[model samples]
Target: MLTIWGRRTSSNVQALMWCVGELALEFQRHDVGHRFGGLNTDGFRKLNPNGTIPVIQDGERPPLWETGPILRYLASAYGEDDFWPRDPTRQAEVDKWAEWAKINVAMAFTVPVFWRVVRTPEAEHDHHAIEKALTALESTLAIADAQLSEHAFLCGSCLTLADIQLGHVLYRYYDIDISRTSLPNLRRYYDTLTERPAYQTHVMISYDELRRN
Candidate 1:
């Protein structure tokens, strides 16, 4: 059986768990980050020296860290043709969007927008910085909106690994109490993603536990 180590609330961990759900792979998940804390243990360090959550151990193979690579490995090893695709060009297209989502959209939104607004105390919150970050995020999301306008999913009409990586951030983007530009295509894509049982189960987790109230 495959084993995953991470808290359920982590976005990265959720991405992996969502991929596992989509692949219908049997796996056991253990809470090990955030408030869970078992990362510094010697046993845990043997699996991942960096002590990052979301390390996956498959059978006797070495544990894998990093959400993107872990997801790619799962899709390649266990997923059907449609999930990861076989054609080099098609796979490249999928990879492009996954990187964009992680580097552009996810990174843009999390720290500058989400952490500042949700995790920071109201008195300490930097509203100006938040606005600036949101402006940048809105610009970044525009590219996704443009792509989604032409295709049902990030890579195509069917859901792919790109969607799994990208879609996880939408719940936080929309659910967070932040002002956002009207992104009709992105919203439609997110709404469509939410219909999937895997996405709902993994990506749509509440962040109320992470909030600073």
Candidate 2:
């Protein structure tokens, strides 16, 4: 059994959960982060020095921190061929987009936009910073839109680690009250992801708890 530490609403945790769900791996999830304050405890600190959410303890192996590596680890260890390829070349292809998604899309929105718009109170919102972040994110998403235009998934026809890395962020991107450029391909991909039970269970969740009144 695996032990994962993080709040369900945390995007980083959600990514790992989505991957775990896709693999149908049974595991225990400990609530932490935000109002759940176990992250500051000595035990949790031993697991992750940075005190980030979504740390995974796999039996005797050392606990794993960081969403990207955790996803790759779970996929490689437990994912079927469709989710994670054994071939190095094929895996590299999936790795590229996973890196892009984490750095470009996830990082762009969570701190600059989501935290500002959703976490911050309405009176204290930084509209200017949000708009700037949105503008920058738009350009990054456009590249994905073009790539999705050519195939059903990021790397190819079937869902892979690449899609898992990027797909979790789509829910907030669409649901948030923000202006977005027309992205038919990205929209189509998101629709396809919605049809997946794992994605719905792990990724398509409300962040109402995270919002300020």
Candidate 3:
């Protein structure tokens, strides 16, 4: 069995969890980081010197950190090349979308939304920052909407690693209260994602608590 260290609420951890369920791989998960707070301890550091959540120990192999790397490793090792692409060009395309989500979409939209709803105190919340993030996010989503109009999934016909990576972030965006932007294609794609049992079980959650605090 594999051992994973991270709290359930962490988005990175959620990505790993969703992957495990999608692959039907059995594993053990330990709650750490954030309110759980074992990340800084020496015992935890030995596994992951950076003290980040979602580190995985695969049998006797050294533990792996960083959510995207972990996802790629898992797909390569156990996903029968279905989660990831085997063809060089297809792989490159998947990698591009995954990287795009991390840098462009995640940084500009997801982080700010998460911070505003989950981390920031209500009294001190930065409305301007939130609005700016929302604007940037809406614009970026328009691109995704157009892309999705041509294909059912991010990297092509099938649900590849790119979908998994972007879907995790989309969960956050879908939950956030934003304007009525014309994103019919993105909306349809998101609806399809929710219909999957794996997504419903692992990724879907109420934003009420995150918003309330």
Candidate 4:
């Protein structure tokens, strides 16, 4: 069985867990990082030098770190040709969406929201930073909403790795309170994502608990 090292609440870790459920692969998970705090130990660093959560070790292959790469590896390895598109052009489209999620979406939206709402102390919170982050996220989400209106998934009709990666971030957005943003298409897409059994089990959690930690 594969071994996943990270706390359950980490968005990156949640993405891997969701992928595992989607593929129906059996694995063991260990709580590490954040409040758990085993990441800096020499044994843990041997697997992930960066001391980040969501690291994974397969039976033979070297351990993997970072969220997006881990998702691609699992989808390609265990998902066969199902979750990933076979055609080169379509595969490129999938890659494009995944890349967008990492660079534009995760950096601008997920990280800031996580820091402000979960990590930072309420008294020390920077409202201006949160506001700026939210504005940037809303802009990006509007673009996604428009795209979702045209296509069933990020790349096209089929659910691919793109959806898994972006969907995890969408989970975070749903928790945060946003003002006056009209994103019907995005909302519909998010609802569809939540309907999946894997999402309900692994991604959806009470915002109060997330904030409390």
Candidate 5:
């Protein structure tokens, strides 16, 4: 069984777990980071000196840290053709979007929008900064919306690793309090993801603990 170390409430962890669930991979997960706080231990540090969550050990081959690499490792090992295409060109096509989502969409939303709105205390919220970040984030979402309009998923008609990279962000994006520009196709795409059991199980979770922190 695959062993994972990360807190469930963590967005990165949620993404990894969702992909594992979608692939029907048997795995055991340990809650760490955030309120759980196992990040600083000597053992955890040996596993990952970077001290980040969502690290995985696949039967002692080695511990893998960083959400992106761990995810690609899983996709390469377990994902089916539609999920992770074998052709280099096709793979690159999907990978580009996955990278794009990671760099552009996820990065833009997490610290900029989500952290600002949810993690910060309400009275101290930076309205100008939040608005600026949200506007930037929405511009990127518009690109996804246009692509989703033509295809059911991010990279194509069927779900791919790109979807795993991008889709996990939508739960917090839609649920959070913010002024959002209407993107019907993006909304439809997210709604479709909600119907997936993996998406619902791993991504749609309570942030009450996060709020209390």
Candidate 6:
């Protein structure tokens, strides 16, 4: 059994939860960020000095924080060779795509794009800035679109840790109101992800609570 501490709506938490779900691991979660507002609490701060969400602890092991390490820990411990290859070379291959997705896609989309459109008031939106951000974002998505064109998943034909990192954001990417450039392969890949029970349960959650209405 695993213990998780993060709100379901958190993208980082969604990624971890999806991993847990995929591995059929038993776990429990608590809401503790954004509107939940428990970050600065002494207990949470002790669990994670950074006071970040998506922290986890497995049985007697020390608690883990930071989304990347926590996900990697789960993959290392629970993931099979297909999901997170045990071979160093194969592992690097998956890690490459995972890092690329986090740095290129997640970083570009979250603060610059999603927050701009979803968290900011409509009246205060900067359309020009938004367009510029979208332009930059699509350039990265095109890379994934191309990779996905050749293979069914980010790392290969089967889902891997890379997919967890990359695909977690697609739900909001598609649901939000924006003028998106069509990349058929990317759309197909995302559509395939939508069919998964774990993805549907964790990654496809509604973020209405985070909206600035």
Q: How would you encode candidate 1's per-residue C-alpha lDDT over 5-79 as one tens digit per residue?
A: 999999899899999999899998999988889999999999999999889999999999998899899989997
For all candidates, the clash counts are 0, 0, 0, 0, 0, 0
Full-model lDDT, candidate 1: 0.90
The sequence of per-residue lDDT tens digits that candidate 4 reaches over residues 101-127 is: 777887777668667866677787778
- What is the per-residue lDDT of model 5 for residues 66-160, given as tens digits with 9 covering 90 to 100? 99999999999999989999999999999999999999999999999999889988988999999999999999999999999899999888999
lDDT per residue as tens, model 3, 1-213: 789999887777877888888888889999998667999999999988998889998898999999889989998888755468788887888889888777777777656767785567788778888888788878887887888989999867788787887787778777765544778998889899999888887788654544445
Q: List the residue pairs that clash in candidate 1.
A: none
Ranking by TM-score: 6, 5, 1, 2, 3, 4
Evaluate all candidate structures by whole-model CA lDDT and list the values in order: 0.90, 0.91, 0.81, 0.83, 0.94, 0.93
Return whichever of 3 and 4 wins on lDDT.
4
Model 3 local distance difference test score: 0.81
Q: Extract clashing residue pairs from model 2.
A: none
| Cα RMSD of predicted structure 6 | 0.7
Superior by lDDT: candidate 3 or candidate 6: 6
* Ranked candidates (lDDT, high to low): 5, 6, 2, 1, 4, 3
* Candidate 6: Cα lDDT at 40: 96
lDDT of 6 by residue, 1-213 (tens): 898999998889999999999988999788899888999999999999999998898998999998989989999999999999999999999999999999999999999999999999999899999999999999999999999989999988999999999999999999999999999999999999999999999999889988986
Model 2 shows how many backbone clashes?
Answer: 0
Instruction: Tell me the deviation in Å of residue 79 in model 3.
Output: 1.8
Each candidate: RMSD to true structure? Answer: 0.9, 1.0, 1.7, 1.9, 0.9, 0.7
